[model samples]
Target: MSESIRNLLEQVKNGQVSVDTALLKLKTKPIDDLGYAQVDLHRVVRQGVPEVIYGAGKTGEQIVGIISSMKANGQCQILITRLSPDIAVYIQKKYEMTFVESAHIGYIGDIPIQKTKSSIAIITGGTSDYKVAEECAVTAEFYGNKVERVYDVGVAGIHRLLQNLERIMSAKVIVVIAGMEGALASVVGGLVDVPVIAVPTSVGYGTSFGGVAALLSMLNSCASGVTVVNIDNGFGAAYMANMINHIGESK
Candidate 1:
């Protein structure tokens, strides 16, 4: 702004900058011009979050274009969810700051990232369920929450989870990933006091219907504070976990 608006009003009393000059500076706030692929101007300011690019079904060029624009505004730590390995490799070749996760192939920048020590525990029912669980973990980490991953402790081996129950209970939030019968969420809910974010993976066959059965089972859990996100939506689960974990940090 060319004029100091707050100072100008005081100046009116003490005779410094004019009211008209103050008005001119107030009218020149920063605004963003919409691009061909996105109108991602005020995302962080309005929603208390930044724009997240969903990499599935989008071309590499489109991903590059989106990242280019986001970077121009100094908004780093961009996350591209559901990206394939090919696309992730392509993105990595272009931008060297990428982290391609094992659970999901999402790409995240290691720059300008927010940092938080309040932890979120990401657990998987089995090895097959790790992909979605990884997505949740990576997403939470990108959103500036410290993450502790507890992998392959499915309900069939109840002792596996119970062995780590203390670690599980230590988290500010817990994301439980499962597929078969989706019983892990309920099991977790019965164990911890923190919010349980359940994610159902499409890991089984015949009766699984690409994870809908697990999704339903999670949604219908009898546990008191169990909340569920969409099947295979690791990003969504992490976003919720970050939101929950950062509640105190914002204060």
Candidate 2:
């Protein structure tokens, strides 16, 4: 059961909340319709995480309306991914939000304290991949996982990555982001005992084919524990890493 539902049940068991009140809380509407979007109000009850807003292709007003509906329904610690800076600024004016321009993410409410016993590491092959790396970092952190970041340590300078070997080896989960040949994932995968999530970005030369080459390379990685996500999908990679990190947690 979700934490919220469990809390409600506990209140009723302790006689702190009347049965009718508990029933009312349980029977609350599962969704809020705003015409343009059907905001999911029960996702937190189903999944440990609430429904995240995809800010791309959404107007500032529409995003605000969806967030408002979620907030009214008692959803806290919302995350909006692929958000543009302008829209983030507009939403910031109406509600408290921290915008990370590099990651194109807008986070609202205080971040939950990390409760997972293990930490997640996010590594990037090059500085150009920092945007995607930041996306993974922000998403992992928002999901309440402790994150360690290692940036610009691609194969070009293997020594840099080697320097952080101890830190990388310490994480329970590792995310490797790259755009060119996507070899970093395999290198990290071979080194780490934990799972490695590879993310390909659309950052390469003409022959890179908008990350297809890198995606294919990662998909075909010879390393045993390497798995690949969609190109430029840092959020997905982080989500999977968070789940892996929390495998033994009570929640």
Candidate 3:
């Protein structure tokens, strides 16, 4: 901070600075326009959260710009979800210490890393659903949550889900991704006491309607704890799960 800014803060501490003055200092926290990128730096200060990079539409350069800006202050862990393999490659080459899984949905880190014995499991109904499940796991890991994945355990093979019952039920939260009829979420919901964030992926054929059937099925889940995100929204599911688990970790 400059001498002027330091004096301003001192006045605020001494009760001489009006609320308006405090507002001005806090207002500078967010949204830095870098022409190509508009960074939301104030999110962490204002909302107790940091901005995330939505990696699907933007070029590798734009993502680099956003994540690099978040890393500038060295406070918040940066996350970029829905990163394609090509972009992941570019990011890996640029940021040497960061992990770039070609199959991963994103990356995570900042300050003292968060970890918990209380785990979050990413569950998927079928092999085709692995990508979304991977995304959920990666994003959760980035947020400092310990994550486990239970893939290819949809209702088609009741035995598979049955095999992992202990792990699934024990988790703090379960993110279930599925396509086809999306019956897995309802089944998992009925069995587990914890929250189930249902993710509908565009993984099935004709009647699946690009996961619409699965999305509706998840929304209509008879199971009480089931919550559904948009079709193919693994990132949204993970983000919500992090928010829910964040409280427990802090306690």
Q: Write candidate 1's Cα lDDT for 7-87 as tens digits.
A: 456787776767777566445433445454753645664555667888779888788778777777656657778788788
For each candidate, what is the lDDT?
0.79, 0.92, 0.79
TM-score, prediction 3: 0.82
The numbered model that scores best in lDDT is 2
Runs with alpha carbons beyond 4 Å of true place in candidate 3: 1-27, 73-76, 97-99, 102-114
What tens digits encode model 3's per-residue C-alpha lDDT throughout 3-118?
34556678988999897977876666567787888898767664555777788899988887787787784444677776777888888787743554634555655523658668
> After aligning candidate 3 to the native by TM-score, how far in Å is the CA of 238 from where it should be?
1.1
Q: Highest TM-score: which candidate?
A: 2
Off by over 4 Å in 2: none
TM-score of each: 0.82, 0.95, 0.82
Which pairs clash (backbone N, Cα, C closer than 3 Å) in model 2?
Answer: none
Cα RMSD for predicted model 2: 1.4
**Tens digits of per-residue lDDT for model 2, 86-192:** 99999999999999999999999876774577899999999999999999999998888899999999998999999999999999999999999899999999998
Model 2 residue 69 lDDT score: 96
